[model samples]
Target: MGMEYQLFYWPSIQGRGEFVRLALEEAGVAYLDVARTKGGMENMLAALKADAHPSLAPPFLKAGDETIGQTANILLFLGARHGLAPRRAQGRLWAHQLQLTIADLVSEVHDTHHPVGIALYYEDQKKEAKRRAEEFIASRVPKFFGYFERMLTRPEHRGVYLLGARLSYVDLSMFQMIEGLRYAFPNAMARLEPGYPGLHKLHAHVAARANIARYLASPRRIPFNEEGIFRHYPELDEPAA
Candidate 1:
């Protein structure tokens, strides 16, 4: 069958849409990136301003008649429908909880570059960004990684994946998180990653998956740049400790 779902997001930057893209890609689901299509971006923007069930931002999913918004909510729906989530309620809830944590991490990462305000240019907030990025590298990164490391060690947890043996949406998200952090804070990650063996292993494992490997090699994988959430500013990166 042809691709049925329409993913509405900024065509240039990976942004929050990448989480949804990874889930769809790993599931091998055929879907069109609406904004990437001709005249589709206009439609997406119009939908954002529409009167009915308007999406507040990009990364919204149009699945048949349902319009779903929010990165976590979109993943939750896709996970259950596409077998990327646990079949059991408790397991599913755990996956959602993990995803929420990932979202929290993402927001903090964004704030590091735009500490003063997203409306302000990075050049305009260079001083504040430097301070925020330092704090993120020294404290936030470890605290988040510490939680993820502990989560992997839980008795019920599967060493290979966040929830269990099966790859879930949370796993894909975790992969994205690691990728973003490494891109945005290479030195910090290089210094900090050795302490997070499990997270490092999982990140490697996800990248090695057949589908993901193919996806990364394809045009669908947008190059990480300053326009995206995970920006690389040499001054923001810490020296290896």
Candidate 2:
């Protein structure tokens, strides 16, 4: 149970796979980031076509024989096993809910750079991307951030973590959300961040966690770039008036 996971993800970008990586790192469990190794892309392709449970993409987690697909589903599994989530049904469900919402936010973030389709380059759809990104910065960003801020500032929560008393996978995902958004939309974040102090606080808290801080400092952490879901484009991230 100590070193029992093989995470198959693209060698390059942090992408969605990073959420699982952060969770595993924080749990202090050893996991092979399979695709990061030599000949690992082939291994990842093999994993995608496995007979019993084939996933059409990367970011699948291999937990023993079981291949957990999708970011939220993997976290749902990991949270239960690693005490990153609560034991009780209501609390566990709440953590899962937050993770799912974060997933949605990630999708919206991706669309900022690929509004028309994933197959096209950002330049190919640059016009659509600008429109999408502008709306995202003006509307969707606030919508998602506001919801999370309210969750953090809720009465029982007292603005510490998403699930109130303890740190959960949801909080880890929140850290990624802030990091990715800030990377992709720096000007927007600078303008909007002061309003969501709780989220920024949560991001800092997660960053300062012993394992996560180490991971961020290490070579294992993939640098953000145009290839990833969170791409930095000043054209796309038009500054607010």
Deviation of model 1 at 122, angstroms: 0.6
Least well predicted 10-residue stretch by lDDT in candidate 1: 50-59
What does the lDDT come to for candidate 1?
Answer: 0.91
Candidate 2: minimum summed lDDT over ten consecutive residues — where? 156-165
Off by over 4 Å in 2: none
Candidate 1's residue-wise lDDT over 105-185, tens digit each?
999999999999879999999999999999998899899999999888787776588876888999999999999989998
Model 2: pairs clashing at backbone N, Cα or C within 3 Å: none
lDDT of 2 by residue, 177-224 (tens): 899988888888889999999998899999999999999999999999
For lDDT, the strongest prediction is 1
Please give the clash total of every predicted structure, in order. Answer: 0, 0
Candidates in order have lDDT scores of: 0.91, 0.90
